[model samples]
Target chain A: MNPEQLNSPNDFQTIVNKIYQNEQFDFVGIALQSSEAPHSIKWDFVAGNTNERFRKIVLRSGIGIAGLVVRTGKPFWDNNLNHYEFSDEMYTPIAKTESLRSAVAIPIISPLTNLVRGVLLAGYRSNKIKISGQTALTLSQYL
Target chain B: MLETTRWINNYFNDSTDAIMIFKDDELILSNQIAKDLQNELELNPQYLVEVADSSVKQKFSPTDNCFSCIIQNKMKEISIPITLAKNMPHPLNYFMIYNVIDQNEKVFSLTLKNRGTIDRMDQLAQQRKLTQYVNRAHEKERKRISEDLHDSIAQGVYSAIMGVRRLENNHFTAEEIKELTTVIESQLNDTLTEVKEMALDIRPSVLDNFGLLAALKVLAKRLEENSGVTINVAGNANTEHLSDDIQSVLYRITQESINNALKHANADEITVLLVAHNHYITLEIMDDGDGFDVPKYQHFNGKSMGLMNMNERVKTFNGAFKMESKSGEGTTITVKFPVA
Candidate 1:
């Protein structure tokens, strides 16, 4: 809730872990854009991740789902990502590397700037997901 | 023999060389191609004087033994490629450099050669050019369809919404009906926005009315506003010489490169510079991000399609596409196209 609350990596990891445990998601992750490089958002804390590929993933604003969330400051959800028409740059590398099918991304507002400095995403590896905008609204309240 | 001569004439000055003489900035004498090219000459390769300031550099000269250095201390000559006319190969020019003769005298001659004479490969190049022609036709259709959506459908939707709004002004309308009308109005507004965005994606209209320079500046500004990324576009060039297809191709290449920088490279900033000389137009795109291995990622799955499309478009126009990237460093793409 405060700036100091998320100062430590352990604190961020615990938050991601708590959300992953509280919510029924196949995978959950928190991607942060550092002030040093505000354009790049890197997934720092992830729970229930299949591999370490998410760690290596770097996303720019308006590119991937997390990046889009950070850029737009709005939740993005898609049941059939492959069917949707997206920009050519909308690759969603995390979803591909993690084998995630359905995903929901929510903006994480910084207490300091009152602006979106990070993105929290919950994804499902299953082919079908009953998730909707309503689910994203509920998930967003968790933060 | 006639066909051969015509084919040769299509690319060269009677299959020989177009020669010209330049004393400082003044044109003394020139052949047909050189005369045609003289009109478009802006920057007169002033660097030739700088290089001449040192010593003359030559590519390879057989006439070196014939000419004596008795006239001007040393017979100075520099052979370089210069484009005399559009849609023609850059002729390797032989310029006889000299000192700035008193206010009236420094005289230098420029000899232009046909660079290449590959008649056998003409048909193959034409076949590739045909493929590019087909691709361009598809994009033109897209532009037409985009215009239809913007002008016709979007306008129709607007009038229909206006009709609905006017109908709601009547006192006979019930509360439920009014709410339904409001819903319909909002739905129509959403459709209008979506249609406008789709039309923009199909083909930006600014690219048509304004030239590539203005269009690129607008695109960079819009993208930078959408995302917090720093995108700077800088350069000045006369886009009139470029054909519609080549201009579109160049714009697409720049757009795709910027997108790639944001998506793949995690770039924070991107800079694009476009410069055109008499012979060719050059576009340089640079991004500051954590770069990756270029060779390894060149063929990486679905993502490679974007790279392939960009490459194919450049090749379609006979442009040179060069990409340099290092892991953790950054990526830079430099593209050069012959005026032809």
Candidate 2:
């Protein structure tokens, strides 16, 4: 997983596409820290067609979607993301990138101290789609 | 001409007050009261009617009535003092009308005057009560901080210092030296444990850094160590995500209850149950400690600050707090605070 080898925009997309191709999810993406990737945190990895709007977002700790998981060191799951209020302004980059409607994020913690380092965001454009606990665990196993 | 006569007649007939109507400088109608009031002022009924008629015909403004009217805003329903020529028979009480306004602005202020007196008294009383409450809150915070420092960091330092002294003073037989080293190591371990427990108790960095569940585990450990009591805590709350105030109040109440049980109850076991139901958080603390007669204790205590403090904290958030205890029976304290 040297990102340099996957320098093309579709490189990260290839990983998410492989997962969704075998699974039932609508979209899957990897949100790495800007400090780690140095280019784009929004479309760092995309498995679907996303707009230029995805690359416009920069998140601070404890703020937007991925930032909350990173800062709190907790995984967030919303089976019904539509029921949850979305401050879309904070997630405009993500929203535009995948045209996402419902979403969930899990923080990948360090193996030793269990500190949060990055996030894996999975979402769908359909209102009826939900990310269940089983699905989240399954996604975590892969991502 | 015919329409003017009808209008004048209608004006006098429709009003209860003394009415006079005119149009195009002609006196068309005058009510009996108007004629009488006019005559009492040594004004010929006909002549006074003519003057009033002409004033209305000219569309005289409110300023024109200033001489006879007390209230300036004509639009206001008010009591206006008019010179009635000493011959008018109606009482002065009839002069006022309720709910009147002067072109939407109140010309006559009907407010209760001298409200300043009562308001000042109320403000003083409020200030005094607020000051008293603030003082009590400050005192509680100070006590919590002091107890935390004494029980945690201070005790830790004392243990560590003793350990270091034993290590430095190395003039003893090999057997005695072996014992001394063991004592030093024990002291060091105890100090470290104390530091961590005290830090957790004073402010469970877990509650702040983590959440209520982590903090509760810390509190349970502290209570067990200090009281020689076993506290069984159960239930899973996504407490890390709960609001700060709820977490604080629950923690404080739990801490206080455990303290009371340890100090007053000769109980060997305590249990804390937390359940989330119906968008509310309920906490139950039960102890198999010696219970006192509820009524007798209430009368004897006469508002213990500890109990009062808990009640006050609970009430501030519009929560419910209850204590159930009977002599020869164990005690149970329950608190429920809404989250959603």
The DockQ of each candidate is 0.05, 0.01
Candidate 2 deviation (Cα RMSD):
25.9
How well does chain A score by TM in each candidate?
A: 0.85, 0.69
Q: Which CAPRI level is candidate 1? A: incorrect
Tell me each candidate's TM-score.
Answer: 0.41, 0.39
The 10-residue segment of model 1 chain A with minimum total lDDT is A81-90
Cα lDDT tens digits for candidate 1, B1-340: 9999888556555424555556765656556665554455432544444444443433233345434333334444444433333444643333332433344666765555454533336656755765675677678767767765665456547655664765567553375454445434533543554465455557877778888988888778655543446789999888977899888988888888887776666666799999998899999999988787778755424323566567767998899888998988899999999995
How many angstroms is residue B246 displaced in model 1 relative to the true structure, after the best TM-score fit?
A: 3.0
Clash pairs (backbone) in predicted model 1: B87-B340
Residue lDDT tens for model 2, A1-143: 54235435465566678777877667776765433222223346656644433343443334445656654556665544333222221332353335567667777553322334357778778877666677668777654
DockQ of 2: 0.01
Q: What is the C-alpha lDDT of each candidate?
A: 0.67, 0.59
